[model samples]
Target: MHNEGKTKMIPFGDLSREYDDLSIEIDNTVAGLLKSGWFVLGKKVEEFEEVFADFIGKEVFAVGVGSGTEALHLALVASGVTHGDYVITVPNTAVPTVSAISFSGATPLFVDIDPDTYNIDTNKLRELVVIEKKRRGNKLKALIPVHLYGQSADMEPVLAIAREFNLTVIEDACQAHGAEYKGKRVGSFGDYACFSFYPSKNLGAYGDGGMITTKTPEQAHTLKMLRNYGQEKRYYHTIKGFNSRLDELQAAILLTKIKYLDTWNTRRRDIADFYNQNIKNKAITKPVEVSYGKHVFHLYVIRHPERDRLQAYLQNNDVQTVIHYPLSIHLQEAYKDLGYSQGDFPVAEKVAEEILSLPIFPQLRDKEAETVAELINSFS
Candidate 1:
């Protein structure tokens, strides 16, 4: 599939191009922050928190933290997930989601994902909750419904089941910035919603950062203290906490980038639409966007039975691709003690082998997208 002339290489993600596109504003924002002198947990962080909270939903409070993992850890602690309790989440998600649950000293339990959306299967979640409640009793403390790949999980039933089982809901919305379910943003549906601002995320910062959104003022206050070494005052340490503050520099950068989130997300959606319509190979399964909400296309993933062969073919043709998660968390060696085996989560295990992420960033050009599609179609 090599071209007569060298084909241009398409990158899976190009943050450098995004920075180049917004270099002026980003430069000015970082410059202003450098001159301000106050860096950690300063006014810039406060401003970004408020702006992000407003973006998620009215009356929601956002707390800036060091990384998305910290956001989830703090949110779990604030919501009372503790040692010996079991927190449930999909096994197909990135390890950080499970790591956050483990960080709270709670054991992680597995659920399968929806074959279409790659989010938690709500029916399986309900069945697990019922069985776990009767067996583990109230020790089954929380549920982290991950909004994987920029689409919200079926939150109505997720929340309803949470209430029925008396389990706290913490949304793993690290990939779902600005994503919505039934007209409401993802962060609003959970007791606490965690987000990551890793450089590649939908709402990425220049470096590592994260946020937790909550509707409760008390929870917000607790999170603020938790992120800043448990300090309620200048020298007062009230509760056990961690050092995980989002610095002013990243906060300022995020503030600049936040202004363009919608536009950038729209461009991402447009690219996904192009891929969806053009990649007509019967062997490929285009991502499904459920009718219940908007998917912001954080990662334009597709599936094929011979996923590895397809990825290698695209690479050989000067196109880039990646597997979202080549290994499901339960199968990873880090969680071997969790007692999960190969067939424990059939859908997640099967999807793990087949999912492939194509080039998809707001900065990616239509020509590059078309080239990617052509390469995929040409793959035998």
Candidate 2:
């Protein structure tokens, strides 16, 4: 139990304790890697990819790359999204989501999100794809459905729509490491699934890392070639590519970390469950878990009309919180040329205003979570 009389500073996220918990094992694994004198796309990366592929199931091929952004870019290139083509994805995502589209030589087209789930609204997506295809004549080449906030998007209809429109589907499972839809893993649902292992992710590496999952052999081969200067064999360039290979160091750390992903995700759910059962203030809206999928609660976001005030209050109460996103990608200064205005995505824009990311890492104490809820309940 927390002593309400004694206040302490609670961080939005604290990775130090997580590291302390794994210090011995991580140190040992890292020491072994440093001694091996083999880094940069070596045996460790190959081993990690095989293990990860099995983890995702269905004989899926996993190719490790430099970062999640690179995973998206490589997947888009493998799926044939070239210059002048448009890639469809929701705008209420990390800027890297759109940046990856630009990197692949495709214009990013925005779609609004389902307010309840905070994932792309598949119905609106279908309508937009159909309308855009008619108006633009097949410039829409791919769909990147982000499994936002550790929840799987309702993928069935999205997949059906993709098939109907002959568009390649890329699952942006960057935040949803082990999330499931209809008892199937998220990365398995699309033609290419991209994952990020940044330090803050559910399955994070100490540094930037990513993986691309696909069922097709040719696509996997192409991704491998594309991530390593277009060379399948050393000094033998097959095509123009980028030097975006995942290094052996991150791979070794990830190999150690992946074993605990499920356990951590389960702990995250337990914390989310605690939050859901408590925190009944009418001023705030709690996140909803869709019936079709499991939400891993990457960020236990809640909404308050006075989100900024609530955050201020929490900060003064010795708790730190952040907005998962303060601004939607379309409205950001970088995408000004995309010609998007404030009213374009009403749900996303509203979410951007109200969302507050409470600290919910696996290492967070139950007492800490209770304190956070108690502060919110006590807020005027």
Please report how far candidate 2 places residue 218 from its true position, in Å: 1.5
lDDT of every model, 2 decimals? 0.92, 0.93
Could you give the C-alpha RMSD of every candidate to the true structure, in order shown?
1.8, 2.3
lDDT for each residue of candidate 2 in 209-254, tens digit (9 for 90 to 100): 9999999888899999999999989999999999898999999999
Which residue ranges in model 2 land beyond 4 Å of their true spot? Answer: 1-6
**Residue ranges of candidate 1 with Cα displaced over 4 Å:** 1-5
What does candidate 1's lDDT look like per residue over 349-375, in tens digits? 999999999989999998999899988
Clash pairs, candidate 2, are none
In candidate 1, list every pair of residues with a backbone clash.
Answer: none
TM-score of 2: 0.97
Task: Output the number of the lDDT-best candidate.
Answer: 2
For candidate 2, give the lDDT of residue 264.
Answer: 98
